[model samples]
Target: MLSAGSLATLFENTIGPAFDDAHEYGYRGEFHGSNAVMRMVLDEQKQPDVIVSADAELLRTRLPEDIAPWDVVFGSNALVIAYGPDTAVGERLEGEEPWFEVLSEADAEIARSDPDLDPLGYRALQLFDLAEQYYDRDGLAPALTENLVIDPQEAHILARVEAQERAAAIVYKNMAVDHGLPYVELPEKLDFSNPEHADYYAQATYTTEDGTTVEGAPVLYNATVPSTAPNPEAGRAFLKFLLSNPEMLTENGLVVTDAFPRPHGPVPEEIVP
Candidate 1:
């Protein structure tokens, strides 16, 4: 499966087994950067039956119309700081104080994914930029990024935290929940989980070296079938199975929509808005 790195934990335990039983095909999901997946499929000619993204709009923005004319907006997730093991710092990191204040402590060692390659990394910058304005701390955004240990993807950041190679990492809340890792929650205002705050979230932006501007938006997970899918029928069937299991999706740390969203192009009969 070509899925986002944030879903690494969920697919490990839930999707693979369910897919295997339903389609009698052994499947293992790969954890890659969401934006990186787009580059791989577009530039490197990588092909996968299913492609999942952290941003719903990316399907239209990054993929050609024929490649992925439609995509399903399946779930919502938000950012959190996943700290290393059971240190006092880790414990205090868990909603103990204003999250920004705690993170600003002298002892905090923050890690972030590479922004250009991964949405998480880009979103992390967005979070900090929003935090700068919301908290009214001048230069806070750049300060937070300063001295951060940058990894290629979210999973790499998680790996560093799990190995105690880093003190903390900014990652998706569901990722820390699924992995049973210690974490600190950010406020809903700062957390890009609610679509209601889309306008407010858009106030924050990050620009890449090439002058590409990445704006902030709610954290939404989208999935699509590539036109070049090896098994189009199986892909649709699998998508049906996933959308049908709203309860299981929640149990695995996703805030799934009550109904499958109507998409733009041909979709499985099972998908319903």
Candidate 2:
């Protein structure tokens, strides 16, 4: 199985066990960013039985048509500013303080995943671009970009923040909560949580290092069974388990969906309560 790094804990602790309960065997999930995991499948010729991604459109980007016709949205997340204890900048990044300004402040260490490698990376950059419009801060995007030290994936950024190597970083809200990291609760305008802001957020977009256009949208977690999966039945069973046991997700700080975001082509009947 391949899963997004952010969902590593959930899959290992909850989803995998549930799968084993029904399948008679346990599988070790290879966790990586959505992009990296897909890259391995396509370039490295790795064939994971199941695939999950932080981006709801995981099946996009030229995934083999037979591998996955559509991706299903299973969870949602909000972006927030997470702070490590050792960071020098304190309450200024706290309540009602314009986070854009603090991010622009020199000496504020910002580590983010690489836009070309991790969806979170591009999302973080898009947040900066959105901040430019939301706060009308003309140079906010460039300033924040200048401060970022890119990691290969979101997990790496989390590791550095956990180690207190950086003061603050743009990360999923659940990540901050799960790690017990105090965070700046970003407004819906910035958090990428409210679907109502979808169009507003879309106003901001970022071109990845490879020049791929990534538009701003709410954070969503989606999963799918690859057409190349060795056991398509097992993949379907796993999705059934997760959609049925959403508590397995909510308990971990991820917001479970009441229903599939939308009918994504074909899905198992068991998945739709």
Candidate 3:
């Protein structure tokens, strides 16, 4: 399986083992930025049994129909500012001050993923853009931009925060939980997690290094088995297990929509509800 980095713990600790026990075979997983994983498939010719991505639209747009005929929207997440409680900035972040205000004044750099490689990276930028507008704070986005440390991997950023090597990082809610970090949750209007705020989120946009513009939308987790998968049968069984048993997702801090596990395109009927 090739999956988003934010889901590393979930796949490694929970789902992967569960599938192994149920199917009587072990499964291996590689986790990275959704875009990076897609690149591995396209550019490096790496074929995994399954590909699960953080962005539903990315799978729909980047992968050709023959590569991934369909995808299932399974889960959702919100952006958060996870901080190291030992850092100077972390001390102030524990106060009643607004998170953006504290971040703008902090001397330590705020860590985030690279926009070119990760959806969370661009989503963090979009969150700041929406926050400035929502708070009516002029130049707030640029103010916070003064201290960004963009890395290619969010998991690495979180690791830095955990080690107190970095003061804070912008990551998914589930990531913060998995890393045992205290985080400041952004409001729905700025977090890009609420479907009702889709229009508001759309106002914040980012252009990647490749010049492909990404507009903010509700964060969605999607999964699919590529046509070139090495183990198509195993991939289909895993998807069925995932969709039928979504409690695993909620336990890992992802929110499942009421009408979720929604299949699109030519997904297999057994996995479709």
Candidate 4:
């Protein structure tokens, strides 16, 4: 199985352990960050029994309808400014001054993933745009990108921040807490965790090299099994296990959304329920 970091926690802390104890069947899960899994699914290289992603936009834009059908909105997360307590920016973020000002400093470094590859990457851009409005910084995007490096995934970005390689990085709230990293809290209005703010957040979008555009919203994580999957039966079974145990994910700092929302187009029936 191939899955995203959020789902990786779900499987590790809940699904994996539960499934292990059940022992009626056993499957090895290979966890990759959202971007990497999208790349793998798009390339059709490794047909894992399943694929879970941090955003459905990846599947909508990259994977063809024939490749997979239903995607479940298994959980939700929010973006937060994460940094180590010892870092310069982290220290300054404690104050009332806007975060962009601190990040604009000469020595500050901001880290993020590649937008074309990761949803968090695009979401990071959205957060910057929101911060631009929230802080009234005209050059926030360019300034934020000044010291940015593309980490492989959201978790990796937090790792860099914790290591103090970068002063701070925008990442999923669950990830920073999962790693026990100290972080400044963004207002709930700024945090992309509520559906009501969808329109405000939707104003932020990223256009990929292929000219595909992804608009931002509350951070929702999705999962799907491709039609080309080598083991559709196993994939369906695994998904069934995941959806049935939503509470298992809470311990890992994730919030499972309602049942899989229907996709824009037709989806595989087996995985839908």
Ranking by lDDT: 3, 1, 2, 4
What lDDT tens digits, residue by residue, belong to model 3 across residues 1-273? 899898999889999899888985568988889888888888756898889999888888888998988999999999989999989888988975789989999999899998888799889888888888899999999998889898777556798888888899999999898888999988889887888888898999999777778889889999999999878988888888888778998988899978798788988898865
- Model 4: per-residue lDDT, tens digit, 1-273? 787754555576668878767646677787766667777877776788778787776766677777765576767877777787786677788764566677766386677777876777878777878778876779887787777777865545677776778778777777777778866667655778887888888888888665778787777777777887887777777877776676776666676655344344555565455
What is candidate 2's local distance difference test score?
0.76
> How does model 2 score by TM-score?
0.91
lDDT winner between 1 and 4, please give it.
Answer: 1
lDDT of 2 by residue, 206-272 (tens): 7755566767787888777887888777677777677777777888888766554454767656654
In terms of lDDT, model 1 sits at: 0.77
Backbone steric clashes in candidate 2, count? 1
Q: Higher TM-score: candidate 2 or 3?
A: 3
Tell me the deviation in Å of residue 239 in model 2: 1.2
Q: Which parts of model 3 are misplaced by more than 4 Å?
A: none
TM-score of each: 0.91, 0.91, 0.97, 0.86
lDDT over C-alpha atoms for residue 172 of model 4: 78
After the best TM-score superposition of candidate 1, give how far the Cα of residue 13 lies from its true spot, in angstroms.
Answer: 1.6
Ranking by TM-score: 3, 1, 2, 4
Task: TM-score winner between 2 and 4, please give it.
Answer: 2
Cα lDDT of model 1 by residue, 1-273, tens digit? 688888877777787787788776567677788878888888746778788888777556888888898788888888888887565457666537666766665365688888877778888889988999998999887777774678876765777777777778898888888767888778887889888899999988877654667778888888888888888766777676677677777887778765445465666556542
**Local distance difference test scores for all models:** 0.77, 0.76, 0.87, 0.72
